[model samples]
Target: MLYGVCYYPEHWPKERWPIDAALMREAGVNVVRIAEFAWSKMEPRPGEYDWSWLDEIIALLEANGIEVVLGTPTATPPKWLMDRHPDLYMKDAQGHTRGFGNRRHYCYNHAEYRRLSADIVERMARRYGGHANVAAWQIDNEFGCTDTVRCYCDHCRQAFQRWLRNKYGEIGKLNEAWGTVFWSHIYNSWEEVVLPAYTVFPMHNPGLHLDYMRFASDAVAEYQQVQVDVLRRESPDKPITHNFMGYFAEVDAFRLAEPLDFASWDNYPNLHFDEKADPLNSAVQHDMTWGLKRQPFWVMEQQSGSPGGNFIFAMPKPGELRRWTYQAVAHGADAILYFRWRTCLFGAEQYWHGLLPHDGIPGRRYEEAKRTGEELQRLSGRWLGTGAGAEVAVIRSYDNEWAMDIQPQSFGHRYMAHFKQYCRYFYDRHIPVEIVSPDMPLGRYRLVVVPHDMLTHPASAAALHAYAAAGGTVVLDFRAGIKRPDNRMEERTIPGAYRDLLGLRVADYGSLRQGDTRPVTLVRGDTAAEGHGGGVWYDIVELEGAEAVAWYASDFFADTPAVTRHAYGSGTAYYMATEPTPALMDALMDRICEGAQVEPIAGIAAPPGVEIARRTNGEKDFLFVMNHDEHSATLALEEPLDELIQGVRHAGSVRIEAGGVHVYERASLRRD
Candidate 1:
C-alpha cells in the first residue's frame, strides 16, 4: 500500500522535483500520479510526440522507490490537436465548441476526437509499456459535461440508436416504455432517434434526457477501453482505471466501475458535511468505492486545505485530514492520496492549497502529512485483507435511485440522503454493513433496511418476501413504491407483498402546510415500543390487521396512523408513513438497532456536528472521532484507544481540537 498525490511539473520547476519527492517520502507518500494536463510538454504537434521529459520525471520518482500512476495527457489535449482537429472539440449545451483553456471541454463522440486521442494513448503505451514504476493508467480525467448541452449531433444520434436497439431490442417496446402515446412521440424507426440534447428535443424530459447521458457515458467508456486495449497490447498485466467523483450524478459510478480494474474517487464535501450530515453518511462513499472494485483503492483526490466548492471551501482543522484518511482506510483504501503535493500556480484552482503553503512555509500542513506518514509506517501491513464483515446489507440500486428522484417531489426527497442517515446509525454501532443491489440475495442478514428503495423488479420483490418468510426483518418506508424504469408502477405500495409485512400501503404522500408535533409517548412507559416513537409523521393507508404503534396527533391527516408494526410469522415489519423528524428517527432507530445484543460506542458528549465511527480490521478495532465543531472539545472513552497519528494513548479521556480527527486503535478482541 502506498500514499500518492498528483505533482505537476508546470506548478514547480524541474529543480523542485527531487526536494518535493524527498518531502513526499518523509510524509509517507509512496506514490505519485504524474502528467495530468501536461499536453504542451508531452506532445508539441498533432503527430509529433515527446516523452523525454515524462521519462525523466518517471525515472526521478522510481529512483526513490516511489510508484507512479501515469495519467494520459488527453485531459488537456495538446493545442496542436485542438487547433488542427477542431472537430474533436466539445461543443457546449449553449452551442459553442469550447476552446482548449478549460478542462472537460472535449466532446467524446467526434471521429477526429477518437482518432487523435487513440494516437496519444498509443504513443504513451508504447513508451511506458515496460516502465516498472508505472502502476496504473489514468484515462482522460473526469469525463462528463456539466453544462446542459445535450450533444444532438449526427454521430451521437447514430450511437444512441444502436445503444437503444441493444437495450430494448426494437423501437416498438421503447415507444411503449416511454409512454410515447402521450405526446405523439412514437418513432417508427431508429433513424429518427436523435440524442435528447438541447436542439433535438426540449430539455423538459429529464428522464428521457438522462438516458442520453447513459449513452454519452457509454461513449466515454468505449474510449477508455480503446486506450486500455492499446495499453494491454504493450503491457497486459497492468491494471487500468479512471478516478470518479462521489455521488457524481453526471456519469454513473456503477456503470463506470464495470470498465475499471478498480475505482478511485475524489471527496471534497463542501460546506454541508458539517451542516447536518450524519458522520457515517460520509463513510458511504469510501465503502461504495471499495465495494465497486471489491478491493482496496487510492484516495484519488482530497483538498489539502479548503476546496473550490463553497466561497470559502473551509480549511480542514487539526487532524481532520488524518481522521478522514483513516476513514478512507477503514472503508477500503489501500493508499492515502491527495489532489496535489503543492498548490496550483494558475488556473481556477490557484486558491486550492496543498501540503506546502503559498507563503513557502510548509509548517502545519507538512507536519500533519508527516505525522500521518509515520502512523502508516507504524501500522504497516495491518489491514491488508481486512474488511468490515457486516452481516447486514442495505440495497442501493440505480433504478431505485432514479425512481426516487423522478417522482414529482420536493427537495428533501433525496435517495442518498435517507440511505446515508441510516448508514450513519449503523456505523456508530460498529456494525459491519454491505450495500448490495436489490437483485442480490437477502437471506444473509438478520435485518435488511430498505431506505427509500422505491422501485422493484418482480424477482427482487420475490427474494425480499422469501427473506422475510425465513424470519429476517424487512424494513420499508415512505417513498418505497413508485413506477418502474419502464414508467409503469412496479408496485405502488412497497410491492412484492410487502403490504402484509409493512402493515400499510403508501397511496400518495406530500408535505403538510402546517408543522405539527405528534410526540410519541409510552402508554405504559415500560414496554419495548413505548418510548418517543410518535411524532410529526407521513400519513398513509393502514392495513386491517396492523397495530397502530404510533399515530399522528395533528395535521390534516390526523387520526391516520403515521407508523405501524405488523407481525408476519415470526418476523416484524416497521413502516414510517413519512420522513420522520430527527428526534423520532433517532428514537425509532435505537429501537430497531436494539435487535443486536452488542452495546453502542460509548463516551462522547460534544457539540453538534461531531461524528464517531468504529470499525475492526485485523485483530485491532479502530475508532475515528471527527470534531466538526467550530471550537475544541474533549472526548472520554472507556476503551483503551491509541491515537495513531501522534503517540497518544487514552483510557478514559482525550482532547479533540475543533474540526480535528482522531484514529484510536486498541488491542484485538477475540469472541471465540
Candidate 2:
C-alpha cells in the first residue's frame, strides 16, 4: 500500500523543506503530493517562471527516499490572471461574477483560462515528467468544488449552444427533446437557446435543466482534458489521477474518471465526541468511488486531525483515527494519503488541522499516523494487488440522479439517501456489495438491487431481464423505470417496460406529506410482522401474476399490496412499492438473500458494529474483522484462521477490543 500526505512546499520557507522531508521519512511515508495550489508561486508574472524553489524541494524529498505526486495546480489561478481578465472568472446564474480570493474561480468554458491551464500543466509536466522520484500526477485539487463547475456567462452560453447543436443536429430536434411546446419556449435557432438561469423561483423546464447539468459537467471534464492531454504528452510514463469530493453530485465522477488511470476520493467522516460514526456511509462512498473505474482507488485527502474551531470539528478518540485509516484499506483503498502533513497557519484552511499542530509539534495525530504507517509496511507483501471482492451489485445512474435533482416531487427526496438505505441492508450483514453503474454487466452477481432508477435506459432494463432469466434475483424499489433516457415519463404503467419482470401494474401512486406514514404487514412463508412505511411517495399495486408479500394495513388504501414478488424464467423479481422501514427492509432483504442463496461472509447471528470484509487475489483470501462498537466483543469463526496481524492461530473465537481490526487468512489456504 502507498502511504503519504498532501504536502504543499510553497506554504513553508526553504529552510523548513529539509525538516519536513526528514520527518516524513521517519514516519515511513513513501509518497507525497505537492504543488496542488502553487500556481502563483510557479508563475509570478505572465510568461515568467520560477523553478528554483520547487526543484530544490523535490530534490530534498527525493534524497530522503520519498516519491512525489505532482499536481497540475489549475484549480487555483493566480491573482494576476484573474485581475488581467475578470471575464474569465465564473459568473452565477444571476449574472453576478463570482470574484476571486478562493480557489476554483475561473470559468471552465473561458478560452483564455483553458489556454492558461494547458500552458501551466505542460510546463510543469515537462519540468518534472521524467524525474525518477515522481510516481504519478494529480490533475487538480478538486474538480467541482464551491459550485464553480456551472457558469452562466456569455462564453458558457455560446459553448452550451454549440454542445447542444452537436448533440441534437437541428433546432427542431432540440425542441422535441426539451418538450418546448408545453410552455411556448420553443427555439427556432441555436442562438435563441439560453441557459436555464434566473428562472421564476429557480424552476425552469426540467429537460432544459437536465441538459444544462450534463453540459456543465461536460465543461468541467473538457477543462480537465486540456490539462490531461498536456500531461500525457509531456509525461507519458507517469499515471494521472484526480481527488474527488465524496458524495458530490455537481460534476459526474464517472465522466471525469474516464480519462484517468484510476480514481481517488477524499474521505472526511463527521466524527463527533462520544458518538460512533456511521462507517457505512463512508464505506458506501468508498465503494462508489472505487466503482468509478471498477478498480482499487486511493484516499487522496483523508482527515488527519480535527480542526480547532466551533464548527463540527470533534477530536477523534484514542484509536479512532488509526482505525478509520484501516477502514479505508478494508474498503479497497490501495493508497491512503492524509490531506496535509502539517497544519497551515496562514490561509483560509488554517483551522483545518493536520498531522502536526499549528505549533509545528509532533502531536498525538502524528504518532498515530506513524503507527498506521508501520502497520501498512508490515502487511505490505501479504495483500499486494488485492482488493475487496463482491457478489452483490447495486445499480446507480448519474442520469437518474440528475433527473431527481431536476424535479424532485417530494421535498425529502434525496437520491443518495434512498440508495444508501438500500445498500445498508447488505452492508449491515457483512455482504460486500459493488455499487455498479447501470450500464455494467449484471450477470456476475447473484442479486441486483435497483433503488431509484427514475430514468432507466431500455438497454439496462433488458440486461436486468436477461440476468433474471439466467437464475439471478433482482430487487427494484419505487421509481424504477419511470422515465425514458430523455427525462420524459414512460407512457406505459409504472415500472414502465419492466412490468413483465415485476408482474405488477401501479394502479395509483401519490406523495405523502411530511411526518405522514402508513402501516404495512409483511407476510412470507411463516414470518409475519407489522411494519411502517413512509417517505415522499408510495404506489398502490395491482398484482398481475405476482404474490403480495407485503400489504398496507392502514390508510384509505388499507390491505393493498405494498410489496410484490414474481418468478420469471428461472429466477425471481421482487418489487417494493414504498419506502420501507429499517425493520421491514431487513426482513425483505433476508427473504431476497435466501431466494438468491447468497450467504454472508459470516453467519447472520453476528453482533452489531462488527464489520467483516474479504479481499482476495484469486489464490488467497484475507478476511478483515473490524469492531466498530465502543465496547469490546467476541467474534466466533467457523473455519480455522491464521491471524496475519498477530501471527497466531485461532480455531473458534477471538476477542476484539473496541475499534480494533483483525486480519486473518484461512488456515487451509495459507501458503506457508
Cα deviation of 330 in candidate 2 (Å)?
Answer: 0.7
TM-score winner: 2
Task: Report, for every candidate in turn, its global Cα lDDT versus the true structure.
Answer: 0.66, 0.84
Backbone clashes in model 2: 0
- lDDT per residue (tens digit) for residues 179-263 in model 1: 6676677889977765554554443354455466667767777767777778778767678878776665555566667767778
How many residue pairs clash in all the candidates, one count each?
5, 0
Residue 276 miss distance in model 2 (angstroms): 4.9
Deviation of model 2 at 427, angstroms: 1.5
Best by lDDT: 2
